[model samples]
Target: MLYAAINAKDHAVYTLSTVHSWRISLSISPPSPLPPSQMTQEQYILASQPNPLQRTGCAQAYPVGIYGWRKRCLYFFILLLLVTMIVNLALTIWILKVMNFTVDGMGNLRVTKEGIRLEGVSEFLLPLYVKEIQSRRDSPLIMQSDRNVTVNARNNIGQLTGQLTVGSEMVEAQCQRFEVRSSDGERVLFSADEQEISIGTEKLKVTGNEGVVFEHSVETSHVRAEPFQDLKLESPTRTLTLEAPKGVEVSAGVGEFKASCRKDLTLESTEGDIFLNANTIRLGNLPHGTTDPLLAPGTTYAKQTVYEVCVCPSGKLYLSPAESASTCQTTNSVCLWS
Candidate 1:
């Protein structure tokens, strides 16, 4: 029984020592040098476990040192900034080269060239104000507008060597009156609502319309009418006088003619014969039935000397040389000689 008891005590001590040594070995044992392919599942799991002696913090928790998610974002931002700055510097250099500007010793920037060329369409939003706009080249400066354009000036003068043409459906000038004057001021074409056309010291010509009319008296050196048709003269209640150096001749188509002169009527021709012809003849104040001897064409006679004629009661006529006639046997009437 004593020996058995001693053996049991030794077994307990050995088992305890074995357990303590195993724990100590486990605590201080180095990891296996073998690769994952050669290591056992349990050894691999042991090697993969986190080291307790290693430092652990917010920064150290990530696989890459000092390069966490936040740090990556900051790095990308800085990289983008650097790239943008480099691009801006390059564009600035290009612009400066294109502009051709130079800096002088006085630190003033100046244009080194004369011309400036723009690539694309350029627009100016503000008004293009200028004191004067002039074209230096021979090409004309043209301004075009889709709608109406007006120019207003207090005084405007235009001298054109070439012809001026105005084309439109209608053109009008409006004012109280208008006048066109010659250089010497002697000739003018004046027009107004109240005043008629007055042409001074110049010939007035009107065409392509109705004939002219004289509202008042017209005194001219001569008057001429050249018409394609007939010429007419009208005097309603006035006298018309036509005086010419030569004689007057009137010719017309076959028509009746009648002329009446008031008071005394005289028919005289300086170098022409007088002709009187008709179907019948009448003399003095006698009617057509009178049988007097004077009505006979060859009965009336006249002597060159003065004479007096006497008419008797029997209708017999006798003549005497004296103013008184008493030679008739019957009572006689004295007649005066003509």
Candidate 2:
């Protein structure tokens, strides 16, 4: 090997001696880091790059990421909610449509024709108005319904004004007069204006007048009158009369009342007053001191002394067993005792 030194301008003017060796060695140093300002554009871009796996795996979900599953769950939940809301809205609309109703001037919804259907009325969502409401058939306008019929109204005021018949009984009613006729030729007449009611039968004719008002509830069954009036009752053959306080008036038809009260009794007529007469009789409890039975034969105990009673035959009253004497003597002994 030879070593030489020379000047660029004068290569022959500057020269160096050379030495030759048997072995030649060369050393390589590690490369230096390039300064940020001095680095090439490619090097700078590569050095500042984000992780490639992070970017790619997020864009296309890998097994480790839950992005895809969460999206699917969100969509399914939204769809289920939408379906449920739609169904609820449909049901609400149907219920509202079925319940729609209105009332007429007579406070009635006259559905006389057959095959007519109504819904939601039992729910009472719509207003109801009438005096008394009942579903009835026998009129040409209304067909007989085997199905359970329901009538919704405030009261049956309008329906009671016309004639109605059930079985052999005929009912004639108006704003004031109410009549009921039986199959056995019995008839009952009631009037609103006059405090009088009449029930006609083959064996007996019961008549109630204004005086009967105070002794009976105006709403007494089989009889009719203003609810506020007083009542009194009388039997001409028995020559008996009965009276009660203002609200204690009661009427039980036929001989039914005989079982509840005795044949001859006198009680306070009104709250503060007491009226008594020779033939006027009030009722006591059952003859045996037992409660009145629901029903009994007319002459159930005519032969027995089931009750303790005072007798006033023509006002000469006496106390005796029914079997001992059929009549109370009008003798001086009995009268003097009284």
Candidate 3:
């Protein structure tokens, strides 16, 4: 049998004979190409050695297919980085624009170099501390409180011009009292309690469209009116009483006075004099006959005879003639002499 072998070191081919058990060396021939499975160690080592010209920092060159896949992955990463940067920049710009619009678009509000200006209904929920509050307009400004509102200024003053109306609503004040006082805290100019309103100053004048009514009694120390005017007391269907602990006096200057009662009139003097004065004196409704004999002194006549009489200044009674008796007595408080 003939067998061939290759030298691992020199890559030389050799022939061998196994029947005689002898090895024969042939003439050196160039090694033939072998399959990868049959490749010598020298050939494997030569194939595995890197090419000096192509050698770099990386160990070896990649295959063509894998190199293409690496290129595609690099491109995808760069594109992803650019898209992320653009999205971040756009988001930042949009956020800044939204903030600018919100700060500038407030109605009736301005931010200037001098200060801030607030117009129209401006309300504050938090506590606002300021030096002063003032109104520049000439029209009336109203401040109202639903419950109670207090204004405290320690080192400043509050001033109001024109008419001030307090508690104008029909509802009363919650505190039930309103007062105006001077700086000294002693004098009260005006005050109102629950039932009474008082003005403590010099003069008070009240004019009501209807009539002023005093529900209870009215008492004063003194009352005086100027000039001559009629003081009238009227009660349509009720009793009007005037009572005094001391005494009541009425004086009319140079005016004629009269008193009349529709029912009955009485003149009573408890402890003083009742004086009736006029230019002339008259009496009526006297009894025709005197019951006492002393009242008709020295006069004797029949029962049917009537007499007209008069009382003279000398304290004597005189009788008229019989014809004038009926006529003189019929006239009102007049004595007709015949």
- Best TM-score goes to which candidate? 3
Those runs of model 2 whose alpha carbons end farther than 4 Å from true positions after fitting are 1-70, 82-128, 131-188, 192-338
Q: Which is the leading candidate under lDDT? A: 3
TM-score of 3: 0.36
Error of 1 at 28 (Å): 30
lDDT per residue, candidate 3, 27-52, as tens digits? 33444456789777878776566534
lDDT tens digits by residue: candidate 1, 234-319 = 45456445445565544444543454445544567779886767686433321112113333333323333443444545444455
Q: How many clashes in candidate 1?
A: 0
Candidate 3 lDDT for residue 42: 76
Candidate order (lDDT): 3, 1, 2
Q: Score candidate 2 by lDDT.
A: 0.42
RMSD of 2: 25.4
**Which is superior by TM-score, 1 or 3?**
3
TM-score of each: 0.24, 0.20, 0.36
> Which ranges in model 3 have alpha carbons more than 4 Å from their true place?
1-139, 144-171, 174-177, 180-190, 194-210, 222-231, 249-270, 275-338
Which ranking of candidates, highest TM-score first?
3, 1, 2
Q: Model 2: how far is 48 from its true place, Å?
A: 22
